[model samples]
Target: MTSTIARPAPDATRRQDSAKPRRETRLRALDGLRLVAALMVAAYHYGGRGGAVTEAWGSSPKVQFPTLHAFFSYGCLGVQIFFVISGFVICMSGWGRPLRSFFASRASRLLPAYWAAVLLVTAVFALPVVAYEAVSPSDALVNLTMLQQPLGVDRVLGVCWTLWAEIRFYALFALCVVLPGANRRRVILFCALWMLAAAIAQGVDEPLLDLVLMPQYAPFFVGGIGLYLVHRDRRDAYAWGIVGVSWLIGQHYVVRELWRAPSPDAFSNRTSLGIVLVVTLGFVAVAAIALGWLNRLNWRWLTVAGALTYPFYLVHEHLGWVVIHALHRGLGLASAETFVLTVVSMLLLAWLLHRCVEKPLTPRLRAALSRTR
Candidate 1:
């Protein structure tokens, strides 16, 4: 009798690769960056609560912190970082694929988990809390389609507002990818035109126009697309150089000066631009690191943390008020204690969501899609 050799199924290998931990990917640096962004968002919300405490009890003997308000202000930058990463990843993944397939794949991956989150939030907020609003069915339906951004509907789920931007970028980029002669030069030119339009709309004080056009954040996404092009062409040096330049722009211009401005209006005009530039640079740096131009940092914990980022982002912002209310009632905790507990809870909840929701669903979805194809 002859011994039989065993072979793995074709779909098994694909599933295994897709489901592998973040550590196995060459793109662990990107995941690390995602984790940082997620944490920054959580910090931002916690910081906001601190600001509220300072505002409510400014003269109270127990409220003696000067840095509390300042801490919450920078949390908004996390969204910019997220926009950059979304641009880069979507561009890279959709490159060379048919537009239909690209849209379908993205829809399949994003919509299921997102709709579930929306339902969960809607159900929990059926009765309004201070920060949480009860949404109408029509509003929720519009949000479910991810078209609320252009419609000027403030997000039903707070964190999902960013996802509206993300979905728009995917759609716009998909159109570009499908267009005739939509090569590098054309894509760049198109992005430049879009950026100019956005800037002009913002300058005119048309917040609705600006929101609809999403002008302020287009460059970071375009920059990500540019990075993808460079990577695809194997222009490693140029990619890293872009990364370095973006870092310098962000550090020297945005974070240092714009972030310090006292007026929100001035900061929006001057510093927000700088933040956008720096975030774009962040995308470049991530790309360079992924391509091995830069040595990887051995941050395994960060890698694991990054895996929980999407879920963290989903839960952290909306649940923040709930957490703060609970802490105020139960612990009678100071702002600092409240902040720490909120962050810890966000991380722990994110870890659970990753294990319980994302991990299980992603594989099954991918398998089902493969079989259907």
Candidate 2:
């Protein structure tokens, strides 16, 4: 008796779908957005703080570009953009991975490039000819961990303060992933708990809780996670609401915080408004990209821009300050010309760092870690 069982077509379709690798959507526009965020941050660090030449560093040069400084004052908003992107990317990355895997991925992605930059910056600070104060050996060691601030040590670079916040966010997200399992339901629940904690912290005005919860920036991350949920499951009105509310709260926080202290330049009011505007635009753009409104922007070079952003961000600022100071004093470059040259040099340095350190080491490190696991 040759009895053959008939298989349903839906079962076959399900099997096929299950067998295929789940390739997440590659939104090239987000890559472009990364470049924009990085540039804005660089601008904020470089030009936003206007000062007299005799005051310190080389910010005296920024006075030459008052208009540029005015626009760049809003560049701090880029950090908010980055926090949102991190949330979105982390959700995407941690979707199916274990806690250890997520930790490994984050470490491999961040540490090597960071270590390389640290070494370079340390070298500069260590040299007396540079006249920058030397980084103590213990502090440098702490800096190597990239948890300097939270660990109660000085950051080797000023911008590194943001990295600790990022690490904390990653740790919190990992806990969420491990607890409830990665799913749309967990995202909503996690965000609700986070915001509730934030509200309590604000009410109590506890510094420790504020430090731990980082409520000031939690909404941005929540908004990003909400965007991911909305994208992955479009029919969820609850997720949509989470996104809308989170974005509004985050925007309000930014405006209120920054509007309090505008630079004394003529563009003070304009700068405050610009900062708020850029932040609002950032949220809208990311949401639009998440919802598939701007998915068609598939420029290959934008990937390069995105790739270089990390190195560029790490290598700019303090190092650029030193370079500008040297150019003005050592090379007889004018304020405007020194600013331009420093920017160009930093871009080239970023490209080299990406090509030499980040690109080659990240894959090998991740692979080695995976093999050990």
Candidate 3:
């Protein structure tokens, strides 16, 4: 589809959509949401005390950003927001495609920039740029698999831990739900089975079970799939039930993680309440987009934002931190100025990755893979 479509006349389109939901139509607002989620993560990494940026900043980042740190501290939860969005989008994309096409689509979208980012981060840090030690060669090779987490190898860059989660989620969704055909009953079944498995995994306290099942994150992904059903199936009761069940499980996990985290941001009823609010709002936002509440948000810029999101996220963390450190420490730029310049540079780098690497290679990659099927 073209990037921009004129908004169809509201009354007739809305009436028809209300009567019969459009399964194939794009949810434009989700693009904007993805961009917001990525920025939230960048905010957390840059402004919170979690990363090397703290060393460069001299004092606590909370001291530097003051008012902003309170909000940014919770921003790592943006990864949860991304998991929800991935569920909705992956289901939408994979619905009718064959197994080969589904995998081709996923690999093409995921791997090109991923390879680039892994290499970029590895090479950049191999220099004496930061105080960080470079990743070992063997570790870097394993990282290329994106299964480093399960294989007991450390991540070579920031934000990669989530990629392993996404990889596993894709495997389960492809093998069980998507390839077999995604109807309401089957999607709901997957959710039910996953919920049960996750509960068992959590109770057993086995590392293998927890890694394979991902008890903490299964809820958000399942909830997103449920929301996609609601979006496509006109307020499906089974789908809504799935969403509700996921929210209940997800709420418990959110609160537990917040309370137990061994960080400065840990353990306040108020912090848990704030995180719950954000997670709830993310789900509600998707629901609104699903229910046609956001049908008016058909702007094109969001489409561009969506295109940039994956590349931006993959490359942002380490590269941006180095930028922050160099600008502030080596160049003697002030904190505020350094922050803006670093963010802008990261955006430019993301755009270049998209325009130069992804645009050129993704189609060829997909075509080559699909040929095997």
TM-scores for every candidate against the unseen true structure: 0.71, 0.88, 0.89
Winner on lDDT (1 vs 3):
3
lDDT of 1 by residue, 338-357 (tens): 76787788778778767777
- For residues 1-373, write the lDDT of model 3, one tens digit per residue: 1214444576754444333223576678998899899998988888854457677666567677877777877788889989999988887777666788889999999999999998988898888756667789899988998878778896887699988899999999999877776655677789899999999999999988998899999999999999888876654688889889988889889888865544555321236778788889989988888777887899998888889999999988889878877888789898789878988898899999999999999999999999963
Q: Output candidate 2 Cα RMSD.
A: 5.9
**Candidate closest to the true structure, highest lDDT:** 3
Instruction: Candidate 1: list runs displaced more than 4 Å.
Output: 1-25, 48-65, 127-132, 152-154, 178-213, 230-295, 298-303, 363-373
lDDT for each residue of candidate 2 in 61-161, tens digit (9 for 90 to 100):
24556567667667888999998887788877877666666777888899888999988998887888775675788998889988788778867777897
Better of 2 and 3 by TM-score: 3
TM-score winner between candidates 1 and 2? 2
Ten contiguous residues with the weakest lDDT in model 2: 52-61
Q: What's model 3's overall lDDT? A: 0.82
Model 3, runs deviating above 4 Å: 1-23, 260-270
For candidate 2, give the lDDT. 0.76
